[model samples]
Target chain A: MQFNKAMILSIGNELLIGKVLNTNAHWLSGELTKMGFIVDSIVIVKDDVSEIASAFLSAIERKVQLVISTGGLGPTFDDKTVEGLARAFSLPLVLNAEALALVREKYSSRGLPLTPERIKMAYLPLGSKPLDNPAGTAPGVYLKYRGVHFFVLPGPPREVEAVFKTSVQPIIEREFQRIDFYEALLTIKGIPESEFAPFVKDAAERYKSVYVKSHPKGVELGSPVLEIHLITFGIENMSQLRSCFEYILMSAKKLGGEIIVLKEPGVKL
Target chain B: MQFNKAMILSIGNELLIGKVLNTNAHWLSGELTKMGFIVDSIVIVKDDVSEIASAFLSAIERKVQLVISTGGLGPTFDDKTVEGLARAFSLPLVLNAEALALVREKYSSRGLPLTPERIKMAYLPLGSKPLDNPAGTAPGVYLKYRGVHFFVLPGPPREVEAVFKTSVQPIIEREFQRIDFYEALLTIKGIPESEFAPFVKDAAERYKSVYVKSHPKGVELGSPVLEIHLITFGIENMSQLRSCFEYILMSAKKLGGEIIVLKEPGVKL
Candidate 1:
């Protein structure tokens, strides 16, 4: 599906404090980009009501079509994303019967008694749909407030990934029309980014929709092993993206650097 | 020093593609927080010229006083951040004599001949100050563009960290006046996030500067632990930040959760 713009709100203290690796943001961005969505901004805020509310306002101000927030949907005191959402949208946090039932069933299947805190997972913004979280206690909240679709996913990556793939993706696909998008990654070894700039610029000029980027790899000490990525979108036909990829690969190969080509939609050349 | 806002621009394709982990963003954010800077937003974009320029514009729109960018300073085709910065600021990209000498000496010390690509590393935005990399071939650039301080470091995590600490920190300290700031973090274990929301709400209401959050430890599948963090921040008198933290910890402890007090500046208890 194609979205005009999206914003990611990664809600967690571990993300801000360096205690945990935040792979969720990167993974989500890639997924959205591949689905033809332009991620306009990403905000990492501690799971605080004010911060989340402020970020929500900022996202709305930016007019992002979608806002996906991860974390702060758990049963602990620190899980304030739901409350933050209520404040942001001026909606009361209410318990949804379907969500409550789902939580009860989830607890029952796990053979655990549902505590008051556990039941709190069912509470969401008023008039919101609860997306089932197959892997965790918290059910994701899918809400559309003031033209922005908000997806509140659990903090656990497994649960977030599952809920996103199963529930959120379908909703998004239904809401937006699918668009043709393509990305090509050219891993060029032994070339520094500076030397690679002119060639990439030439290629980008030649291909209007194509973009080239260079990244360093190997030894965290900044040893120069560079990877170049060429991305194209909105090809009139499938052959267009492929031809762009071919032209980039040929030029990169002719530059005497080892090149590995990767085509979008699951083709590795 | 207290900064209400900062933005990070991670300029690399490896991060966007999941080829390399973006530890630099996390580490830098953590460091900035510790130094009393609130990291409001982070953008990970490819080494595309227009993308970098647009990202800068976004940061400016947000009114983020401190804008730090990592990557695209090397001598390869993808290393166009310097040029991109020039475009963003409407300045010229010129060969800096000092940067050229540093690049020459760096290659000479390693007994490597300076290639055209290597010489490309000497180019910098007009009136930009070069920050020594200490561990990499590319020196970082520190410049003021349109009243915002920009620190451009290499993409490598280690180099970014070192350059930021040695070069950027002192400059920031000198440029911005110190504002009395105090922060405390309280780590809570075993409590589900939803159950803890009331306490978070109560604390936030009572202490306007306090913020609480929860994060699942080992976010991947099969991870066994979860962490809840209560953070309080205030300018000048730390008593408010401290009182809020203590109250939350005491309440959580009374409710039978494990609480670990973390060391913060100027807090005895």
Candidate 2:
């Protein structure tokens, strides 16, 4: 029953307080979409343990195939994402020897002592494996609980990117089978979205499998255009993608509009 | 008791599909936080009506003072945010005279006829007032359901910014009392986050109001710095903020760390 749907949770008070922009969620969602996973929702919450648990549980209850959380994997007291995940699934927080070894090595090589705050990261939820984080000290966490795979990565975007590339990407490629995911952007200029809305709606109805979106570009008066984006999932639905594309292209031609940008249907991540 | 809290919901498939980056949520969250509102959560959902309604209602049930949504206030069929708002509050969709007049004026001024889809933007939730959007055609929507104020602005960042600046900001200032919000970033080089995590945590507990975060900056093998961000909401707690600042300053001095960047606390939006 796994539908290749993913949900993203970003845990940090700095994010909530808007001290940090959530580039991680945007990057992850884009990456996952490229990987053919339908990202259901992206949520940003503070570093509260209960709030984290509730957000996680809601995703779990919705039966998403994967949930990716960034931030709150550091050594500070506010970094309670692991504890939150543990509380969400009722798993005991256990100190893993391997994570501790990595932590010790990282600090020792840096000529620093192993402090309690640093050691706190070594304790993960029971039965979850740690993803090696080459970019930083905190190793990312990975756990598969009842068909849903959860990966908790560090807050730093660089660390999250490195860990996702080295560890999570490989595992995702090996484990999850990706479907045909193609998206095309047909940028039409010199047409108000209202004039082309009917055509877009007709295309959406005709091509039931493809998603049709008309994004209004250029907010200024006198010369705004609509960027009609078309997307379809599943390898067997390439025809649907083409049909929607041609329909929009033809519609643009009839309306005397120019196709400014035509992004082909590959991974645009 | 209405607390100064807000939740942001981004309504668009472009956001969910990662076709467009979510700059709106970040900008609005930062502005709201700077205005002394505690932004609780930021949620991004697709253009589906039920999904939008559910997310909006959850924010309402949480009793947040405000819920702001960006996107889907357009002429396209996928633009379903207004309908979603109507469904969420069990209100009938009513066409407002002023909104239709504005839409007509915008279309006629450009030497274009107002299409049915273009007129659709005039339909708003019952009892909701349309905020004038000088930057674009679709007027922003404002509604007060039960106790929460819901503001739905157009998806384009420029329109959202302009509408907020011209319409929403004044209403917020007039209705919601202001509180002092300050945040400072004290960047220290040559100090591992592990070494300073304790101080940040201690400051958070000591200050009670100020949220202290230690963000590890620079991912290289050497010469990394930790950016300690401290934020306080109330102006009466400046002394507490100063106490936390001095403690961190002294801690960095003990660790032989150099202050790389010190951004003073005066709303760093």
Candidate 3:
């Protein structure tokens, strides 16, 4: 079974300067992973046009099936995401009629005039459709280039969530089949990572479908706490994922690991 | 004076899978920005050798002065960061004596034998120096290649912080002269982002050294709250940074914006 690959680009100067935490990338990664796309990379770039363009081109070169970029879709001058996307594909930036109507309706409802600053949000790359932003003035953009479907979203967390759920999610659902992605976390103590490392290695080699990773949460020599996360993509069923997880737990038991918290598969933490 | 450019690579499957939130990227971006480096991009890739090599090559192609990668330096099979770096530069991975000694001492202190999994952490790319991990077993790797300084750190947040503070920070201080980077945040209400955007654009143009960005916090038509962040790099003194910030405040006041909060430069939020 072939899995669709996806990439996320988070564009903003606030993100680059560390003034804003990139919760958008994390949120989108979760959404896409649940939808069955293997999120290959999450890149955070500044609001500079060249940087944004280069990032987009790199994603294109990687041949990802889906690309979702959040941020830089505002009215301000620093909102250069669309311009950068246009430059990446050598396409012209045009005033999208649907986007302009959305922007006009949003402002008119608030009894505000369409100033040049407001109209700036209407400009999009050529041959792109506008995704209606239910929460903001700047309409999200949707374009397809070189077989890669791109969804360009706004910077604000509320707006990103709204646009992705309302506009982007449906398209993803229609375009790809959801793979059975199941995972469980085992918070185990009393075994150092160095000693447990062999178990993880052997388990990874044994279970072809499962990916096991050990995150050291506490000191190795003193009170060692390791969060062993087991994940399986494209599993036949939950039982298969569970069996793989159970094997890892049994191995942990051999080394006197006390399981503090066992977050089972399909259970939200 | 030209600002040095830097890039951050956060490599791990956990990050790409959204199992982990990348606070390291944010923290390092803040630290690098405070040290006068222009953080161009932060790229998070999965723990794949080719993906890691490609990310590193892109950073080099951009001519960044410094590059720091966090994660994938461990005693497991998936810890392929050092191997990836070697592949990027066509350099051979060799067991460094210094790194071996450090790893041996770390393990032996706990009365643990030198297993192959434990010994795996000592392999380093040729000519790279090992930065002792004060908080973990895997020693951080430091290499200068083609005019770009690279620091490869481990995954855990505490280890990343400890290694950076003890090993990376001193080298940066000695290599680069500090440049003045001062910033202030002004939280104002009653002015919508579209209405306030023109002033931000003008301020950005007038104060060439200062970067002005506005983040919308509240509804536009309702009680609009916006966070206007003003940043000035290479300023002569704090007074100049203050003057630039004050000018932005004056513009905000002209629009009848009520000042809700003013986070002064050098004040931690």
Candidate 4:
């Protein structure tokens, strides 16, 4: 069977405008892949409620086992991702008491009165828990709808990471099957991608169980370096994975290519 | 009139898997914003033909004037982005003579026989012009369907950027109304984001044309730094833009927060 697949939804207008780099999408995907989840797509939508709701519904309809969203969980008028989730699932937006406490305490600890706008952060779709967000005022969200778990985190990189590690990770471990992830890389130098394509295609056709992909490091035709990346999922034995890696490495050397770097068990490229 | 809007589609499974950072989306959006286009969304999909075709059609249905896609332009099995575009528009995938010339030249210069796989790069959707790709073998493609222009470029960043500058930028300049893009950032230190929210929502309500966003820099509630970002498009003059900028700056100062960094007329954050 294939690996458990997930999807990422990054909600904001800033992302579309390029005001912020989507380090969250990149970071979360890497973590999820390491945790044995196949991230299928990362979709970014505008701040409008309709767009946000549509994106959420589409992910669920696609039946991705896990859906993680970062951003649009703020105290501004534009932060409507939760309300969008509420609309998507036909659940009433209600103040989660536990979430309210976390948010309220964050402000009270700083000796600041929680304004109406600030208190708005406590409202979430019914049947959802407020994830502890030690990093900011807006508490993260955790909910499961139709067997799909959705982890909603804050916008900032630091805030997202903190909430994810402390609140969301444990839930994922309990709910999903964790498989060992492995990757293999062959950094080939002095080959244009055209010539390199035949090798990849052959490997892909030959090794049905392994992924064979090429990443051209430099764009120039005579570039010195390119990356041949391979990954296998749900394989029980490390030796089987290593054999898959060796088969490709040996084939690359047959092309008269110089192998600059090799990660025995593929490290994240 | 509304601001010129654009969308980005990064076609590849590598992007979704976090194997590759979508620096292209960020870089393209920033450049488009600088050229005065309101980038609406960045959608990343797998290399599957149906997904790629569907993503392209969805962007067009959203009425974005310019849709730029990167990736899946190589000669491997997964490189099916062009075939996807052809399916989306119901165009025949035929080899254009000019594209053939470019592909033939690239291989001929190296005294290599153009294999069938190499020749596959020449076949593109009918009625498309091959954009010059000086950096890679697969020539970029440009086509207009139903009043939308699609620029399909290679996966590598340098190749995407190079072809964009040489072939795509001129078309964007000619077809779209380019406005003067300006941004103003007021980096406030020592404020909780809860304390910072009302200011942004109020400014967003007041400045109808400007986008006001607040980013919590540090994780602590009482952290010493926060950033308020503002952007506007199609302002007639710098004074008009400056006036919009002043409204937010003055309000932040009134809150007794220290303005640590001010990017007068915003730079890409």
Number of the predicted model whose lDDT against the real structure is largest: 3
Residue range A103-161, candidate 2, lDDT tens digits = 88888886778889988999999999999999899999999998889999998888999
Better of 1 and 4 by lDDT: 4
Candidate whose DockQ is highest? 3
C-alpha local distance difference test of each model: 0.73, 0.86, 0.87, 0.82
In terms of docking quality, model 3 is medium
Clashing residue pairs for model 2: none
Ranking of candidates on TM-score, top first: 2, 3, 4, 1
Worst 10 residues of 2 chain B by lDDT: B260-269
Model 1 lDDT tens row, B1-269: 24557888888765654446678888887777666666776777767798788777777887878888888887766677988888887888888888888787877775666777878888898989899878777889988877888898988787887898889989988986644334555566655454455777687788765554545553212322334454544454466676776777787788787766665435322
What local lDDT does model 1 show for residue A182?
A: 63
Worst 10 residues of 1 chain B by lDDT: B218-227
TM-score of the A-chain for all models: 0.87, 0.96, 0.96, 0.94
Candidate 3 Cα deviation (angstroms), residue B209 = 1.2
Q: Candidates ranked by lDDT, best first?
A: 3, 2, 4, 1
Complex DockQ, candidate 1: 0.32
lDDT (tens digit, per residue) of candidate 4 on A152-188: 9988888889999998889999988888677877788
Candidate 2: segments with Cα more than 4 A from true spot: A266-269, B1-3, B267-269
Instruction: Please give the lDDT score at residue B46 for candidate 2.
Output: 88
All-Cα superposition RMSD per candidate? 5.2, 1.8, 1.8, 2.1
Once fitted onto the true fold, the runs of candidate 3 whose alpha carbons sit more than 4 angstroms away are A235-240, A266-269, B237-240, B265-269
What's the TM for chain B in candidate 2?
Answer: 0.96
